[model samples]
Target chain A: MLAVQTIADGLVLGGLYALAAVGFSLIFGVLGVVNLSHGAIVMMGAYLTWFVWHTTGLDPLLAIPPVMLVLFAFGYVYQRGLIQLAVDRSSLLASMLVTFGVALMLRNLLVLVFSPDFKSITPGYAFNYLRLGEVTIDLVRISALAASLALLGALAWVLNRTRIGRVIRATAQQELAARLCGVNARHVYGMTFGVSAAFAGASGAILGIVLPFAPPDEANWTLNAFVVVVLGGVGSPSGALLGGLVLGLISTATSQLIGPAFPNAMMFLILVLMLMVRPAGLLGNAFAASR
Target chain B: MLAEALARHRWWIALTLLGIAAAAVVPFVLMPFHVRVGQMILLSTGLGLAWTLLGGFAGYWSFGHTAFIGLGAFAAGLFEVNALGTEFMRTDPLLGFALGLLAGMAACAVAAALVAWPILRLRGIYFAVAMLGVAQVLSELTNSIEAFQGSLGLVLPRIPAFGLRTEAVFYYLLLIAAVIILAIAFLVKNARIGQGLAAMREDEDTARMLGVPTERYKITMFVLSAALTGALGVIYAHSLGYITTGSVYRTDFSLNMIVYNLLGGIGTLVGPLIGAAIMVLLTQVVLGSFLNLHMFLTGAMLVALVVAAPKGIMGGLAGTWQSWRRRRTAAP
Candidate 1:
């Protein structure tokens, strides 16, 4: 029964990790750099959702769309304004450093407004748990899981079916070829970045429910996103989903088997092991193939 | 003709001598707090310079370089507590100090070489993130292990002999360390190994095709840097007196290294020194009320530097000079 409950909980966290990793991987897929600020975007989304809940007393679930939209705009403007210049440099390290810079800015601004103290959003139903015989799950975790899976579904649909998705994928595959095909390179890149940010924001909102966060949490979030993307494959969304689930289980199991401090260590160990054993990751081979 | 060249460069010679003299006497000139700040600058500059050799020169960019630092600190602390008996550790801290630093250096070099050999093959972001993970794992192990004092760390039994005059004692230590780091960096920048690293940075494939022993060169440099950085960590831990996993195993130091090195001029010899000075000032002076704001400034500076001048402060000036010279030649 305990085992069943632990696995179920791992799946819930995995769903959340998948949502977080997808946006991060998408940005990496479309753009060569691993948008270091993706976690900050998620952090921003969490704060925004918390704000909506704090001021209007709205259900946090309903707040995801507006938060995602705002984050999308923010991401678009950020890419067009600053990163456009960096992208031209054509160095992965430079772009990653650039986003690290933006992340620092965002983290500081968040701290300026919110202070360095940890904050969490708990709606009335946050504490409620759904019990099913030997298995039990927190309602908040379930909602986060459901919300993330739904968004993942929507993202998968867009990437596989839609025109914009196809353009974004083509650009990822070959930027010059895509540009020659009249793809409006900057616009497509900006749109793809915005979508990626929106996904991050949604994940952030869910993160607020699952855990308490301060300004520095963004760095950890970014690290986890990287671990997920690398584990899944650099440019694969479905790969991200699987990676997230695997990380979730691994982290949860580590916490259960060892101690809480061990999970963070385990995540990195797995990452190191993966890089050494299979740099392409479980689903990573398609990364260079597409991007 | 040689005499004329010497006369023309007289100002540079005078300034260089003047700078050395000033550094020698700085302990007496500044107040104790600022002396501490100077010590900070020396430490940061030293760390940044060490990082420059690996990330800046070799183009590997290990975001987990802090792992070496944490391990060094832990190794030093463990040596002081476990190896040195309480009696000897208290009275002859100088002996323990020397041994602690040596232990830190040996442990760091071994760790870096062992890890770098396998991990360096991954390339780019994977290598960077993997390095970060390595650091995180080491830190966590320190946090969980009782042998590491289990997050409480260790208090170096303070022998007043070691810090009879805190300002003079550490200032000289830091100054000497910084000088050594800068000197080694200058030496490395001019050597055959340095040229190999430059070639590797520009294009590994081309360098390899040209018969550069890129693997051996990278591991050697990485080990050298790890030893240097670990030595710096020993000094840092000693100065602090009390060292803990949370305090010593700071990943943020890795970020600072990257930022400072990049800000100063990623590959330039003097860039890290300049960058570290500016960063230490901001961190110490303007830290309390505006801690997060400082972070914002650091980040904004990074973004701006990368976009407008990817070469950093020193690199930017060099770029301008080259461009201006080209323009002048073409003006006719």
Candidate 2:
């Protein structure tokens, strides 16, 4: 029963990780560029939702769509204007540096405006819990899990079924080939970044409801998302879902079994071991195998 | 032509050496507080060199270098803290310093190997993100462990009355470390390994095909970098007489190192040192004034540097010099 409770709790946490990782994976898959600013966007979305909820008495869930739209536009413009210039550069280091500069700018901006204090969004029912058999779960956690699952399902469907999804996958597989086949790789890349941003925005809204956050919290999320994405597979959507679950279970189990401190070290150790043994991640095809 | 160029630059080299000599002697002549600041500048220069090895040369940007520094400081602190209160465990201060350096390097090597294995497979932005994750994970681990003193942090006991508390001693120590690091950098830049590193940075696949053992070079450079960084951390801890996760393991330090390299001129031998000096001086000016305004000014400076000259101040000056030479040769 204790084990069951831990697993259940782990699964709930995994949902959030999955949401973050999927957005990260989507951008990497479609654009072949890691969005370093994804975490900041996630933080911004959370703050936006929190502010709306605090000032206007709007439901945080209802604020998600508007936030997503705004962030999507922001991502689109960012890629079209700034990132497009670096698209032709063989070394992606320039883009990474640019994004890092942007992140620093955003962080300092946040510090100037919001200060360094931690803030959390607390609705009336934030801590409300529901008990099922011997397992007790927070209502907010359950809702967040459900919402994340729904988003993942919808994303998977869009990737598999939609016309834009086909173009995105094609672009990911071979950019020149896709271009020769009359696909506008640039447009797809921009749209794909937009979608990834929207996913991140939604995740942020969920995170705002569930966790205490400050400006630096974005860096934490970005780091964890990178781990999750790598653990799952760089460009695999389903891999992200499984990776999050595995990471969540490992972290929770390690905390329960050993001490809380051991989990992070253990997680990194596992990641390292996995990389040495299998560089393509657990589910990912080997580099040679993919070729 | 190369020898002639070197001959022409002899005066500049002489001037630089003289500057170093002057800097070395200033702590004895200046106030104690200024000496302390000089010591900090020298320490930061060591860190900047460590960063230069990997980021500046190999093009493998690591934002988690603070982990090594923090580990070094903690190891040294652990020796001083006497957590177990054992007399035999107590060693000479110099031995403690050496142990701290080794332990810090070993920790960084182990952590780097573990983290870099998976992340190294990634390119560009993904790689940077992975490094950030590594830092966060290590910091979180540090925070969660009680033996590490968790958030309260481990405090080092004061050194026995050795009469080495004078700022001049610290200045000399720091200057020696700085020289050693610079010598290493000079040797590395002129060696075959440097050529291989340059090739790797220019293009990895081509470098590998051309018989450069990219992975081995990266790991070796990273380890060396971490070891030097750790040694500097030990020195810093001893000078400050306190160690904390917040101070030792800071992203700000990592970012500042990158900025220093960039502002000085990445890939150049003397860039990081010059960059460190400039940044430290700028920081002093900023911090001397109002807090908010200082940050705003620094931010503005960073923006201007990035926009106006991404190659760095040194690179821009070199370009100008080269253009003037070209025009002079072309005329008449």
Top-DockQ structure, candidate number: 1
Model 2 C-alpha lDDT per residue in residues A1-291, reported as the tens digit of each score: 999899988888788888877877777666666666678888888888888998998888888899889988988887876666554532356555556656666666766777778888888788799999999999988888998888888888888899988888899889999999999988887888888888888888988888888987777667667668767886666888888888888878988988766766777777656655666776875323210
The digit string of per-residue lDDT tens for model 1 on B19-79 reads 6679878877878888888888888989999998888898888787788888898888788
Which regions in candidate 2 have their CA more than 4 angstroms from the true location? A86-90, A161-167, A174-187, A282-291, B1-13, B28-37, B83-130, B159-169, B203-216, B287-308, B327-332
For model 2, how does the per-residue alpha-carbon lDDT over B86-122 read when each residue is reduced to its tens digit? 2433545555455555665666666666555566765
TM-score of chain A of 1: 0.96
RMSD of each: 3.5, 4.0
Cα TM-score per model: 0.92, 0.86
CAPRI class assigned to model 1 = medium
Rate residue A30 of model 2 by lDDT.
65
How far is A186's C-alpha from truth in model 2 (Å)?
Answer: 4.3
Instruction: Please state what fraction of the native interface contacts candidate 1 reproduces.
Output: 0.73
